[model samples]
Target: MNELFTRIVSGVIYAAAIILALWSGKLATNILFIIFGLICLFELQNLLNFKNYVSYFVFPIALIFFNYFNVNDEITFLFIIACLFVKLLLLRDLFSLKGRNAFRQKKHLITLMYIVPSMVFLTLIPKLYPDYNTYILLYVFILMWINDSFAFLIGKHFGKQKLFAKISPKKTVEGFLAGFTFTIIGGILISYFNQTLSFYNWVVVGILVSVFGNLGDLVQSKFKRKALVKDSGKIMPGHGGVFDRMDSIIFSSTFVFGFLFVINHVS
Candidate 1:
């Protein structure tokens, strides 16, 4: 297929998927994230060249599920403890796998380092803080999309100066600024509705979302460079893997999530 055709198809499908997912409501959103989490783990495994299929699947699912169980008194601490023990013991398997398989096998834990805590924060944010979460989460995600999409266009048009040519040759400082500026608007606009956020908070979150979000993109690009792969997967047609799609959101979510919590507590 032609690159243009691929890109067009990819954009439509991804936009559709995201819309459908958001429309599906909270439970559906969580489920969708879980599915994406699995895909990311799998892709990372392949990219990193991990070998153990058991680690590839079990731990990602377990991390989320265990965290879920931890929510209730009903789910035994003993069970969670056992899972933790097994999860820790799996370290041997990581060393056992050589080369690419090491990453593939350990992909779950690697992502666990990122997603588990974020999900925990997400799961609790709405309940712990009110009126703030909807906008925060919305900005976290929308800004990420803005960053990814505009960065591409801006970079293409005026990306004379390379930002990280060694990692992602195409990314440029001009594109980064363009992407960051647009995405930051999400924080400000969402702030209008949030009631709790002042203009200052909006500015801070916006800066954070843009800065860390761009860093997140660069981080993923570096990974792709190491893997010697262009895109994470073919699912997005012109886009890449779920990893590619959600790269900025991964960092933005955590950064925004923590920022709000800390601010809310301080006040």
Candidate 2:
């Protein structure tokens, strides 16, 4: 019952924050993500046991500049490429026999390379979209939530095969497919209200979130397994930590940003 109450309260707060931020416009959204980035950084640092105040100070300053400056597409593209490369390296480490030590040895570098750029791209979404549409950002979050919620429900009831037992034992193939299916549905529904993105584009977004979002969760699970902790932090009751909550968004935001970047350039 206590756990149930915590989940409900946390869900309400999380939903409210996302909706309010979306309704408040671009600046508020930017500020909210900046705060999210910092909290995630803090949680990650704790998980990795790497105590560095540099990121704490640098992230906000860098975010402020990125938000204020008229950053060119080339730079944004380069950042996305860097983020992808780092993610690939992380994936490689995840699969390797020595994955655990490799991650610990390079925690700081990974934090700088992976976490920083992901947050930057996440903050860039609203700015990149037409009219600085906050709905685009909101749509991403909504799809993520929908995918996560349904995946758990379907997986708990009917999951048979493990998706990646080593990294995340609880995840199952059935759950993944269920999440992917519903995310596509959620995306199409969101498209009806948000005409800025076509139905096809929203479906594409759904695919990205369903695939990469799960990967993100697994990536964090690896981190937690290594750290021998259940969650990253206790910032959000029943939700683990800021890092736990934002892992999917952090991991998947780059792809979303990349898509938007290409769309903007071609159109």
Q: Per-residue lDDT tens digits of candidate 1, residues 60-131?
A: 465467434535523433433433333333333323434433234445555545444444344344433442
TM-score of each: 0.74, 0.95
In every candidate, how many clashes are there? 8, 0
Residue pairs in candidate 1 whose N, alpha carbon or C atoms collide under 3 angstroms: 45-104, 49-100, 49-101, 50-100, 50-101, 50-104, 50-105, 51-101
lDDT of 2 at 68: 81
| Per-model CA lDDT versus the true structure | 0.62, 0.85
| 129-192: candidate 2 lDDT, tens digit per residue | 6677777888899999999989988998999999999889999999999999999999999989
Candidate 1 TM-score, C-alpha based? 0.74
Q: Residue 230 of model 2: what lDDT?
A: 96
* Clashing residue pairs, backbone N/CA/C < 3 A, model 2: none
